[model samples]
Each structure stands twice: as structure tokens, then as C-alpha cells.
Target: MKIEIGKDFPKFFKPLYQEEFELFSHFETTAGIPTVLFAITTWKENGKPNVCFHSWSCFHGDKTAFFAVMGNLYQHTHTYTNIQREKCFCINFLPISYYDKLIDTIHQNDLETDEFEVGNFTLSQANVIHAPIIQEAFINMECTLKEVQDLSGAGITAMIIGKVEHISVDEKYAQGYERYGKDGFMMLIPAPQNILTGEPNQSAIASVNIEKYD
Candidate 1:
């Protein structure tokens, strides 16, 4: 069965482009689903600097966040420090197919260690920031922290709202790219879902909503 939704902006359902689409299923949606590793580097409250590697992220569209933290805990995060000082960050999303390299980046690399050097990845300077970009990944979002909300005043994990400064991606991930289309990119849906329905609808629904506000 097929549901006729908007195939363009201001429509109810959005058709997925081959490269830049995710699904909206009850079990697993694309909004906040994907495991990635990023290098957390900080300048410092003092005059020193440091960096570490983390394997988690729950970001939002430059205004809200998808993070969930328990209690007050903000001491040893290099990412948080960088954002606090520079007011910017770059999140690089990786495909789970590169699990091994992702794992390599999750360890306690030194302050000046480069994850791309250890992992099977490439680094490129971002379009709008001084931070490096993951050239091998499917998506890279350079964002500025608009706000950081501490839920319950517990600093364990603050919901960071970032304004997307810029976005760079592979041409293959383009929405109209035929290669990542239904039969093109052999990727895991990441859940039990309708391959055609979920992803396409996500783009469609989002497009419709954007039009409503615009």
C-alpha cells in the first residue's frame, strides 16, 4: 500500500532523495539515531588545552537537543569545553559499517592525538569553522551553539542547541542522487521498517512542516 503525501515542500510526505534521507518509525527514527565518534578538544578554563575521544552524540537543529543526562557532570569533556570557548562545533556522522575505526577513535587518545590518523578516516578543514571535518563520512554539520540547557540543573549532559552554520556532504548523499535511491545504496534501515515508506516520508513530512512555518 502507498500513501500519497507531498512529494515536495509544503506537502505532507516528502520523497527521499538517494543520499540525504532517514526514516521515521516508532521504533527507530532518523532524527536522533546514529552512533558516531568525534574528537573532543578543549582550550581550557586555564591557559592549557586538552582533547579526548567520545562515542556519543544527541544534537538538535541548532535550537534544541536530543540528549539525556542523569546528574551534574561537566568536568572532563573536551567537546563541551570547545563549545564553551569557541561557541562552535562540528559533528561528523559515520556509517556503522566502519565500526572498527569508530572504536579506534573512542579511546583515550592524547591531547594532540588525531583520530583520523589512527582510524581509517580522512580529515578536511570545515567550511565555516577551524575544526576539522571527517571526509569519509556521509554527513558533516558545522554548528554554533545557540544555547545549552541544563535539564533539572543537572549538568551531567546539557542539551546543546546549535545553529547550523554550514553543511558539507558527499554528492552520493544528495537527495536526488540516484545511487543512494531505493535500489542504489545497500544500507541498513537500522530497524525493522518499510524501506520505501519511512525514509521518503521523513523528508516529505519535514518539508511540509518547513513550508508551514515559512
Candidate 2:
């Protein structure tokens, strides 16, 4: 037997359908999807450095990238405010070993404490940007702020686009870079579930083959 519930469906089920729709929307938006994470570094007017973890970042063009910062939550964050003042920042691609520290930086709210000290990470001077790069990171991009879009009206966030000035990669990972596009990079990403605790996981690295069809 086959039953079709079209526009003529009973009114009694309308509320149930609406409730399920909202739940689906929430889950789709908030579900922990795997994304490449970067630690962005900015410098204050006094030359103090601040770092923030951002998973909502991606390459925008051949020499540009964009990232979103939660305006409502990080309105007073040093990294957000500093970037506005300095107009430059560094994006550091951290390894899986720093996953725990990266999570800690996200939750930390103290503006006075430098993230490098708090996370126990060393910083090196960037060749083109005032902001320093993480010494331990395998890759670092020095960028200048190209644009800042106010997305607060739609969602309490701001989209920051930057022009990549320079890119530094560890020599070990740089060998035969053309052969391996992104698979050669070793970085942490969100996991579907924890293997040990069965909780929402956070750190995992996987490689996938790129298939092209003409």
C-alpha cells in the first residue's frame, strides 16, 4: 500500500512537522562538521600579541582568504580589536599536537594574558607582517586585511578577508609539494565521535583521494 500526504494533509500533524523542521535546521547548522582550523595572530597597539582559533576560515581566491569572528562573543577580544587597529595578521596552521591548547585558547577570555604564553607556544617574526608567526606551526601565512564585512545584521559575526602577503612552510613538508596538494599537510580537524569516550570528538586527520571527471 502507498499513501501520499500532500497539501491536503490533516491539520493535526502541522505542528509536529513544524517542530521537526526547526530541529533539523538547528542540527544542520550546529553539527560538528570537519573543518581546517587556523590560529590567527594579531598585535595590539602596544605590540602585545594575541591569538585566536578559527575553524570558519577558507581560501577565498588565489592569494586571499576569509574568516569569520563571532562579534557577539568576541566583541572585546584582543585578536578582533587588534586586527582592526594593526590591519595585518598571521594565520598559523597548527599540528594535531596543539589541539588541546587550541581548544583552551577559544575558551579563554583574559585579554591581558598573551596566547603564546598561555598556550606555551613560541613566536617568530613574520617577514612582511607586524604580527608574529607560531614557531611550531608547519605553515604560516602573513596577510593584510583587505576587507571587513559587518555580518551582525544577519548573524552576530564579521567576515574578514585578507590578502596573503607571504606563505611559509616547513621544509620537511615542502618537498614535492606539487605532488600532494593538501594531503601532505598534517593538521587536526573535527571528528564525528570519540573512539574512547564516545563523546563529540575534536581531533582527527584523514586523507582522501581527489577524483576528477571530465
Candidate 3:
């Protein structure tokens, strides 16, 4: 026998936090998707540096260009507004060691706040864009805003596509295989619900481990 979930929010679904289901669909916990974790850096209109700890995104390219397809970005966020006004942003990838620092930026973020200072990070200007970059990051991808869409048409979140203009990698991680294991990339493991009992679980941070190369 197999358990089946439909499009509607599951009645048996439980929320791990207040407004958890209100902010995210029950399907998020149902499927418990995992995605890479990174920081989206931008300049707030107030001239303050902003950092948005983010996930639910993918990167790809064709022969002509590359793109960063960022999903589930809250429309109310400063990062969203900054990107809209500035037309650019920077994606910074750090190891798990910086997870707590990144989280601090989330709590300390205010329109007047310098998020880089909140996280005890050094701010560096991006090469091709006006956005700020985290100096401690292993990789920094400077991007120009390409498009923004309200995929659900709910006006709550948006899918933002950014054309990757430039990329800078730490010398140590420039090697091919070095971009794995503890020092490589951080991942966000969405909270999983017990399908049988509909019990909510806690989300977790993870590191990539190279099991095999094929």
C-alpha cells in the first residue's frame, strides 16, 4: 500500500511553529525538500548592507548565459525590495561553520541595520554589481536581476531569476573535488512530517559529503 497526498493542505498536518503552515505550504514538510543554503547580500535603500539567509534555489546556464533561479523569496523582505531598487544582488556560499552567524543576521535585520556587522562579517563590494559580498564566503556570485514572478499569484512570495554576471571562488576551493565534505557547502533540510502520524519535525542544517563520483 502507498500513502497519497493531494494538492490541498493535509488536515492531519501539524505545524512546528506558529504560522508555519501560513508561511509555508504543508507540502513543504510533506516532501521535505533539501536545497543549498546561501546568503543573498544587497544594499538597502538606507545605504545599509543587508544579508538574507536563503535557500530553495537552483543555478543553471546555457551556452549564452547562466542564471540563479531563487524561489520562495518573501516579497516583504528588504532583500526583495533592495533587489528591485538596486537591480542586483550577491549570493555568498559559506560552510556550516558560518550557519549561526548567518542566522544572527536574520534576527538582527532592520531597515537601518548593517547586516554584515550583525553577523560579524566583513563586507566587500561585488566586482560587477553594486551589492555587498561576504568576505568570509567560499564563493560569491554577483548577479543582475533578470525577472520576478509571483508563481502562486498570492502576492506573498516570488520566484526571482538573476543573471549570473561574475563569480569569485576562494583559492583553496577553486580545485574541483575540494568543493565537498565539511568545508564545501551548507544545505537546508526542510522539516519532515511523519506521514503516518502527521507529526512535525525540526529543520536541520547539513553539509555535503561526496559518497561517490560517477
Q: How accurate locally, in lDDT, is each candidate?
A: 0.48, 0.62, 0.94
- lDDT of model 1 at residue 180? 35
Please rank every candidate by lDDT, starting with the best.
3, 2, 1
Q: What's the TM-score of each model vs. the native?
A: 0.52, 0.66, 0.98
Per-residue lDDT over 1-214 for candidate 1, one digit per residue giving the tens place of the 0 to 100 score: 9534343432232334433333222333223343334433333344233333443344443254332221222434656666777776666655444545665755734556655666756667678875666786567777766777676454455555666777776777677343232323222223332434454433110000122322
Q: Candidate 3 versus the native: TM-score? A: 0.98
For residue 167, model 1's alpha carbon misses the true position, in angstroms, by 0.9
Q: How many clashes in each structure?
A: 6, 0, 0
How do the residues 1-214 of candidate 2 rate in per-residue lDDT, one tens digit apiece? 6433343323333222334333222222224354566788887666666778876456756334444332222445677688888898888876556767877766763666677877778978999978888988878988888777766444335677778888898877777443233534333343333322323333356433447635
Query: Whose TM-score is greatest here?
Result: 3
How much is 53 displaced in model 1, in angstroms? Answer: 7.3
The regions of model 2 sitting more than 4 angstroms off are: 1-33, 62-74, 152-155, 176-214
